[model samples]
Target: MSSISIVPTDPQRWPLHVNAGVHHWQYLDLAASTKQPQSVAEKYFLGLLTELPNLPVASNFQDASRNGFRFYQKLQLNDGHWGCAYGGPSFLLAGSVIAMYISETEIPAEWKIEIIQYLSNTVNKDGGWGLHFAGDTTVFATALYYIALRILGLEPTEPLVSKARARLLELGGATAVPQWGKVWLALLNLYSWSAVNPIPPEFWLLPDWVPFHPWRWWVQCRVVYLPVSYLYANKVTKPLNPLLQSLRQEIFTRPFEEIDFNRFRNTTAPTDLKKPLSPLLRAANVLLRFWENYIRPDWLA
Candidate 1:
C-alpha cells in the first residue's frame, strides 16, 4: 500500500505552490522559506468567489441609474480612474509588454515568474500555446509571446523557446504574423518599416466631416491607432539589443534578408484574422500609402 500525505492542508491558500502529491516533507521546507498566513489564504479564496446576490433587476430608469453608479464605484482604480479588464484579444498583452519595456518600467521579479508559470501552465496539452488560452494556435499570438519571453531574458537556446520558435516558423514565420504582430516587430526593428501599412497621424488633422476621421472609429481601435500613428510617423524603432538579434533567427523560416516583405503586407495567419480585410479597407490602405509618401509630412509634421 502507498501512503499519500496532504501537502498544504488547505491548497487554496498556497496557490503558488508548485509541487504536487504526498510531498509533505518538501512542502514543509517550502513553508519554512515562505510563511503564508492562514487568514491571508482565506481572504484570497473569498475574493475569488463572485457569487454575490444580485440586486433586483430594475425596470425603471432611476433604479437602473443608481445601480449603475454603485457598480461604477466598485470598479474604481487605485489612482481614481475607472478600471476595466481587457480580454478577448490575446495580442493586447504583447502591446502592453512592449510599452512597459520601452518605457523602462521594471516589472517585479515575482510577477515575471508568475507570468511565465501561468503561460506554461495554460499552454495547450498538445504542446502549443494559442491566441487565446483556449483558442487555436496562431503565428501572431505565438510569435508575440515567444518574443516577450526573450525580451524578459529567457534564452532562445532553451528547450521551451526552441519549441515555440519551431512552431512559429512552421506557421510560416514573421511574414505570416498578423497586423498587430507586424507592428510590434517593426517597433522592435526586427521587421522592415515598409512591410507595415501606413498608420498616418495626419488622419487626426482631418475635419469632423471627413469620411475617415479617426475619431469616428471604435474607441479601442482609435486609441490603439493613436500611438501607432505617433510611432509610425517617427519610424520609431528600438536600438538592436542582443536579444533582438537572436530573435531574428528564432522567429523566421529563413534568413531575414531573404523574406519578400512586400508580398506579406496583407498576409496574416488565418486563425488570427477573424475579420477578413474589406475592399473598403484595401482602398483605404492604398490612400494611406499615398498620404504617407506625399501628403502626410506637410499636414502632420
Candidate 2:
C-alpha cells in the first residue's frame, strides 16, 4: 500500500498521521530517510497506485457546478470540517490505554489491532519508535510504548517485542527517557517517583498576575502540568503486578535494582534533548526540589 510522508515545521519533529486529511501544510517522504525527520507541519505522499474515478461529464456547466458542490457536501462533517483518523501516534496509545484501564472500559479487539498496527507500521526501520512515528526513535517514546504493549498482553517472544526491547536497551534504557515518560512510569509504579523532577502543585496557588503563572503557558502544557503536579504532590502511584515486575527487568539496560534512580531526574538521552533546558529553568527546578524535599512550610501543604 502507498503511504504519505509527514513533515513538521520543526524539520526535526512531526507526529505521524496528524488529523489525517485536514491540512494547509506540506507533505514529506518517510522513505527518503527514516532517520531524517520532517518539518513540523509537513506530510508527503507517494505516487498513486490507481486512477481515481472522475465524475461523468455534466450536461452543461451548471450541472458540473452542482455535482462539485454535492461532492464537497459529502466530505463535510457536522462541525463543518472533514474528519480524519489522527490515529497514528504511539505515545497517545499509552495515555489512552491507561485512561481506559482506569475507567474500567472495555477496548474492543479491533481497537487493540489498530493500535498495534499503527505502532508496527510507523516505528523506525531500526525497530524503535519516536515521539511521533515520523520523528527519531527516542528512549521516551520507546519506553512508554514498550510498557504499553506489555500491558496489552503482547508476549516477549513476539518478534516485534524482541526488536523493540533491543532498541530500548540500545537507547540506554528507561533511565534515558525524559521527564514526562518518567512520570507515566512512576504512575504505574514501574519506575520510582524519586527519579522524576519536582512538579510541586503549590505553583497552582500562585496569583494569576504573576508573570510565570502556569496559566500563562500554552493550554496543553498548563493542563498537563496541573494534573501531573497534583499527582506528584501526592506521590500518587498504582499497585504493581507480575507483568510490570517483569517489565522492570526487561526494559532497562542496567539491573533495575543497582541503578540510582535519583541521578536521572533531569537526565534525558542525547537524541531526545531537542531543546536544551535553559540554565534558568534548571536552577529553578533545583531550588524547587530542595523546597519539595525539606524546607517547604506546612501551611503550604
Candidate 3:
C-alpha cells in the first residue's frame, strides 16, 4: 500500500484555482512559500504529528476493534467523504476550446489568454506535447493542440509552433495521428473524412437483444460513440483556408499528394494504441468501406 508521503516533495506552493464552470490549476507563491522554508522540526510539527507513541497496543480482539474504530474516525474529513481534483491531462481543454469556437460561443479574453499560456507552459522539452502532462509526445496530442493553438490565433511561424511542427513531422506527421486526431482534423478540413473509420448511427437503432446492441457496451463508451457515429455518417469537412493549407504542408513528412489517406486509417502510434485491431472489425471495415463508396443511403448519413 502507498502512503501520502510517497508523493514528491516539492516546496509548499499553493494552487490558484481558475474556475470557468470548470476548475483549472496554476501554482503560485512558490518563492514566498519556500523562502525561509520551515526547518524539519517546524515542517512536521516535530514528534507531535506522529501517532507512534499514542497508537493503541491492543490486548485482545475487542480492544483491537476499538482502536481501529478510533483511528479510522480520526482520519475522517470535517464535513463529509467526497472530494475531487482536476486530474491533470493535457488534451481535454482542446476539446472545450474547439467546441466553444465551433459553436461561436464568446470566450472571455482572460480565458483565451490563460488557455494559451497553459499550452505554452505545458509544451514538452522536445517541443511537442504528450497525451497527458507527464506522458511523452504522441501524434494524437500534438495534432489536437496544434490545431487548437491555431484556432486560438497563434501563427504557425511562432517559435513554439515551429518547434512543435518539426517534432510532429518527425513522428510521421498528422497523417500518422490516431483515430481521434483524424476525426478532429477531418472536421478542420486538414484531412479527408473518408480516411476515418466508420461509426454508423444506425447501430443505435439496433434491437436491444442484438449481440452488438449499443446498450450492452459500457455506458461511457456508447455515450461518446453514439454522436461520433452520427458525425462520421455526415462526412463533415471544413472549408479550405490558408491556415489549413499551411497545416497540410507543415504536418507531413511526405508530400501531401503522395500520401494515401485510406492506407493510414488503422495506423496509430504504439504508445497511444489501447487495443489491437480485431479481425472481425477489419472485415467489417472492408464491408463498410464498400458501403460508404456505393451502397449506404444518402438520407441515413
Instruction: Report every candidate's CA lDDT.
Output: 0.68, 0.71, 0.69
Cα shift from native, residue 23, model 3 (Å): 7.4
Q: Write down the TM-score for model 2.
A: 0.74
Q: Number of the top candidate by TM-score? A: 2
Q: Kindly provide the TM-score of model 1 when superposed on the true structure, using C-alpha atoms.
A: 0.72
Best by lDDT, which number? 2
> Residue 284: error of model 3 in Å?
1.5
Error of 1 at 158 (Å): 3.2
Tens digit of per-residue lDDT, candidate 1, span 1-301: 1011212133333332223321111213355535653333223332454344466799999999988876565544334554233433667666667777777798545445544655565555444567777888888878888887766667766566667777877777778787777888898888887989878887787899997799899997998899888988888898887777777877888887787787888887775678888999989899888867877556465
Candidate 2 structure quality by residue, lDDT tens digits, 127-228 = 788877788888877887777666666777766777889998988888878888888888877778988888888887889999989989999789889988
Q: 195 in model 2: Cα distance from truth in Å?
A: 1.5
Candidate 3 regions off by >4 Å?
Answer: 1-87
The residue pairs in collision within model 1 are: none
Worst lDDT 10-window in candidate 1: 1-10
